[model samples]
Target: MLLSLRGVSKSFGAVHALQDVDLDVLAGKVTALVGDNGAGKSTLVKTVAGTWQPTSGEIFWKDQRTSIRTPRDADALGIATVYQDLALCDNLDIVQNMFLGHERLRFRLLDENAMERAARGTLAELSVTTVRSVRQLVASLSGGQRQSVAVARAVMRDAQLVIMDEPTAALGVSQTAQVLALIRTLADRGIGVLLISHNLNDVFSVADRIAVLYLGRLVHSGDVAGYTPQRVVEIITTGTLATAAT
Candidate 1:
């Protein structure tokens, strides 16, 4: 496994956001995390992304116990999160946005040419060629192109585990397909991916495994091949797998 959450739990004041959640994400596989609103999906992803520290339990990376205190710590460990917002600066170009905080430097000077070249190479690796040029402003690119840029930025950082929240939430048919293909490509390249999405159609099409969270707890987890859409839906609504087994 590339990453594992063992007995992970978190609380905010008197409310529990997560309760004893156990999840494993393997390298080169897409693990889909599905849950309704307030099912602790976002909390779990936040914990994994180092946005919030777990109140209890442990996180392991490559079988070694690890504690991710901040987002930078997670990034250092090769874990990158692309939330629903995508965090791209619309005013900046692809290369500039990609290397925003971590710009390349040479002899105490910012290396714009080197950064652009690296950004181009990363995008090519993901087979993303729809953009006219990396110099174009992010605000002008299509939705799929913007998403592609965000993903390329993560890849450029040598991310081993990429966590995406609602990647296709508001995209058009073709754009959604494009983003989904990029996700599959990431898994094919030996990257562990945790995808949080409500669209079961997209989930079933791309995920290798499914983990369902309900009321702050992980109620069910298994291979996607063993569960049907109706069964998974039952589990999601009732927080039980008994109906799914039938």
Candidate 2:
């Protein structure tokens, strides 16, 4: 496993957002995390992304137990999260946004050429060819194009594990397909992806594994081959298979 969580739990006062969750993500594979609203999906992603430390749990990276107490820590461990909002700077161009904080420098000056080359190369490698140019402003790009830029930036940063939250939300059918293809490209290049989404069609399209959460607990997790859309719906609704749902 590239990343693993054991006996993980999180709490806010009397509310338990996650309870004894165990999950694993492998390099070069996509793991889809599915659940209904308020099923602790956001809580789990936030905890893993370093937005919040777990109340009690163990996180292992490549089998070594460690604590991610800050976003920097997560970055140092090669973990990058692209939240639903994407956190892109609309005013900046694709290259600028990609190298926003980590801009290249030469002789006490910004290395625009270097950054542009790197950004363009990363996008090309990921097969994001819809953009006219890396110099184009992010605001002018379509929804799926913006998503492609966000993912390209993460790849340029050498992210080993990318956790995406609702990546295909609110996208048109064609745009959604584009983003889903990009996700598959990530896994093909040996990057681990943890995709949090409510869309079953999208999940079934690219995920090699699936983990289902319900009411702060992980109800089911395994290879995608073992689950059907119906079984997943039942688990999300009643925390069990339909045959077992009472």
Cα-based lDDT for every prediction: 0.94, 0.94
C-alpha RMSD of each candidate structure in angstroms: 1.0, 1.5
Model 2, range 37-139, lDDT digits (tens) per residue?
9999999988888889999989999999999998999999999999899999999999999998999999989999999999999999999999988899999
* lDDT (Cα) of model 2: 0.94
Residue 116 lDDT (model 2): 93
lDDT string, candidate 1, 13-112, tens digits: 9999999999999999999999989999999999999899999999999999999999999999999999899999999999999998999999989999
Runs with alpha carbons beyond 4 Å of true place in candidate 1: 244-246
- Report the poorest 10 consecutive residues by lDDT, candidate 2: 237-246
Error of 2 at 163 (Å): 0.6
